[model samples]
Target: MPAMTVNDAPVMFDMDPETPLLWALRDAANLTGTKYGCGVGDCGACMVLIDGEALRSCLVTIAEAEGRTITTIEGLSRDRSHPVQQALVAEQAIQCGFCTPGIVMAAASLLRRNPDPSEADIREAIPNLCRCGVYPRLIAAVQRAGRVTRRRETISAAPAPGIDPADAARAVPAMGPASGGEADGGTTEPED
Candidate 1:
């Protein structure tokens, strides 16, 4: 039996030593989020996080994954609240849902490496083939996730409040629809 940590929990597998991690996860561990697409490393469908890096489970033998951290899409979040998952949902990036788990894992890995990935960066990082041709929406989702991650980082990195409460309340540029009128050289009448 091989002992390993799966989804932050310890798991022991009693399968063939040469069995791929994909079967060990789905069959023995009951973690089906890691799909088997081409049974080879060509497709990203079997992608999973191994020690925080995206790896194709099909190509990795049980011995290779022993004593290492393995995180499946199911372990990404309990409520499916991972940024990648949330962005995919918001963008309606799902088609048949068969490819979503792998895509989600791949996206997570990409975001971890580049929090503010550009469209090209996302395209380059994520090579997971989607049969439905949802590349545009997937790109949009990656962009949105990047924005959210940046916003959170900004908020968390803000300095402590100044001595004067008034100083912390400094005014910011108007961001409402009225601001657009100003940019377009249009005057708005004062409300009565």
Candidate 2:
């Protein structure tokens, strides 16, 4: 069994030591945010923060992760409030969303090390591939996130999670008797 602290929780994997951390997370731990792109590590889709460093979970085995701290996208923020996630949404840098998780993890790791990362630094640090070709916006988004992290700016583009029931009802039009619609068990249309 390999013991590791994941998302600030101590976890032990009851599987083969040689199993890749990606499988351990997705299959055993049910952390599916870490994706599986290129299993050989060329793709950054399996990226995760291992001890505050962006590492490919597919390339790192459970044995290598022993006693290490791991951070997945889910651990980054429960409400998508992380600067990286917010900036990504604000800049609309995500498409298809298959690669977004890995990109978020990579960007989060980069920002942690360099809160004021330059475009070049972001490029160098985040090798995650976005087939959506959001590279240009991604760079800008990272810069925006850096500013937010450094407290130089703020963004309210990312929606807050867990909407209140009342607010949700207000946003959505009433579909029942409240909207003047009949709530009776009888059919609305005339009988044939």
Candidate 3:
């Protein structure tokens, strides 16, 4: 109907208002993090935050989300190192990473609502399907992520917001001119 604001950017929905929010976000707004799962909202892969509430974007129509502040998984953090991601990585909860975004998004919603969620609460929050068989780890990760401890000492003062492959290579400590090894890109056999 009118212009909408998503992730602090204004956009106009020229198509019919009945268009699903997922397509509207992915196609029009270019927010692809909110993925397309089951169109009937059975799979929570399309879950997004609408005014702080988790909703299936595939089910929510543009008319429903008109002028609402919708936050996709991409909008969760500047980097993927958010607590959920860190815990998920720490717990080794991801496989194929298809269902994870939805589960993590749902768990993130749960954590925001209830900082200390129980096992049932965590499980109830994320009903999304995970064919990869990491559900236990997923649940545990959600728990661990909620009560994160930031290590000030280990954290460098100049933390990069996001890692760049090129920058990461530059940051590697220089190796002394020692004997060649696998890491030095040479065989360890003695010279002829």
Candidate No. with top lDDT: 2
* Estimated TM-score for each candidate: 0.77, 0.83, 0.75
lDDT score of residue 136 within candidate 2: 95
**Per-residue lDDT for 15-59 in model 2, tens only?**
999999999999999999999988999889999999999999999
- Give a tens-digit lDDT track for model 1, residues 72-139: 99898866667777787778888988878888888899889999898889888788888888899999
lDDT of each: 0.81, 0.90, 0.76
Question: Regarding TM-score, does 1 or 3 come out ahead?
Answer: 1
- Per-candidate Cα RMSD to the true structure, in Å, reads 16.9, 6.0, 9.2
Residue 153 C-alpha lDDT in model 1: 25
- Among residues 3 or more apart in sequence or in different chains, the pairs in candidate 1 whose N, CA or C atoms overlap within 3 Å are none
Task: Give the residue spans of candidate 1 off by over 4 A.
Answer: 152-192
lDDT of 3 by residue, 104-184 (tens): 778778888886778899878888887788988987788777776323112112232555656555554233343355677
Report the number of backbone clashes for model 1.
Answer: 0
Least accurate 10 contiguous residues by lDDT in model 2: 173-182
* Cα lDDT for residue 151, candidate 3: 31
Worst lDDT run of 10 residues, candidate 3, spans: 149-158
